[model samples]
Target: MAPLSHYLVLSGILFTIGVMGVLVRRNAIVVFMSIEIMLNAVNISLIAFDRYLGQHDGQIFSFMVMAVAAAEVSVGLAIVIAMFRNKPTINLDEFNLMKW
Candidate 1:
C-alpha cells in the first residue's frame, strides 16, 4: 500500500484546486462542483489517516460528511433552480436575491 504522505499530498493538491475553483469560477454550478471536490479531498485524507492508524473513526466521520454533502447538494440545487427560474443566469455576480 502507498504511504500516508502520498495520500495526504494528493488530498492537498485536490483541495488547492478546489479552493482555486471556488475563488476563480463565476458560475454557481462550477462553484458547487468545487465544493464537492473539496469535500472529497477531505474524505480522502480522513480515510487515509484512518487506515494508517488502524481505526474506523475517521471513516465514520467521512461518512457523516458525505451525508451532509448530499443534503447540501439537494437544498443547494433547489435554491439554484429557483434562482435560475427567476434570473435565467447562474453567474454568481448576477445573483443578488437578498438585495432590496
Candidate 2:
C-alpha cells in the first residue's frame, strides 16, 4: 500500500501535467481531456485530504466538482461536435469562427 503523502505527491504531479497539457495543446479535445485530468487530480487530492483530516468536506467538494465536470464534459463535447461539423478539425488554431 502507498503512503498518504505518496498519493498527494502523485496527485500534485498529475495536476501539473494536466495544466501543462492545457497550456501547450492546440487541439480542443486534448485540452478538454487535460481539464478532466486536472479535475480527477483534484479529486485525488481531496480524497487524500479527507482521509488526513478525518472530515467529509473534501469528499463533498469532490462530489460537487464531479457534478460540474460532468456538465462541462457534456457542454464541451457538444461544442466540439458542432465545431467539427462546421470545420472538420479540432485544432484550436483552425478555429476562426469567432476570430477577427
Candidate 3:
C-alpha cells in the first residue's frame, strides 16, 4: 500500500497544477476545469487522512465537498453558457460587460 506521505505529495502536486491552470488560462471553461482539479486534490487528501486516522469524518467531509463541487459546476456552467450566448466567447479577458 502507498504511504500517507505519498498521497499527500500527489495531492499537493495536483493542487499546484490546478492553481497554475487557473492562473495561466484565459478561457473560462479551462479555468472552471482547473477549479475542479483543485477540488479533487482536496478530496484526495481527505481520503488519505481518513485512511491514515481510521475515521469516517474525513470521508464524510469529502462527500460534502463533492456535493458542493457538483453544485458549483452546475451553476458555473449555466453562467458560462449565458455569457457565451450574450457575447459569443468564453474568454475571461473579453468578459468585461459589467465594467462599463
Candidate 1's C-alpha runs over 4 A off are: 96-100
**lDDT (tens digit, per residue) of candidate 2 on 1-100:** 4678998999999999999999999989899999999999999999998988889999999999999999999999998998788788888887665955
lDDT of 2 at 65: 98
Overall local distance difference test of candidate 3: 0.95
TM-scores of the candidates are 0.94, 0.88, 0.94
Lowest summed lDDT across 10 adjacent residues in model 1 is found at: 91-100
lDDT values for all models: 0.97, 0.92, 0.95
Model 1 lDDT per residue over 1-100, tens place: 9999999999999999999999999999999999999999999999999999999999999999999999999999999999888889999997665977
- Winner on lDDT (1 vs 2): 1
Residue 57, model 3: Cα distance from true site in angstroms: 0.4
By TM-score, the better pick of 1 and 2 is 1
The lDDT ranking, best first, is 1, 3, 2
Q: Regarding TM-score, does 2 or 3 come out ahead?
A: 3
lDDT of 1 at 34: 99
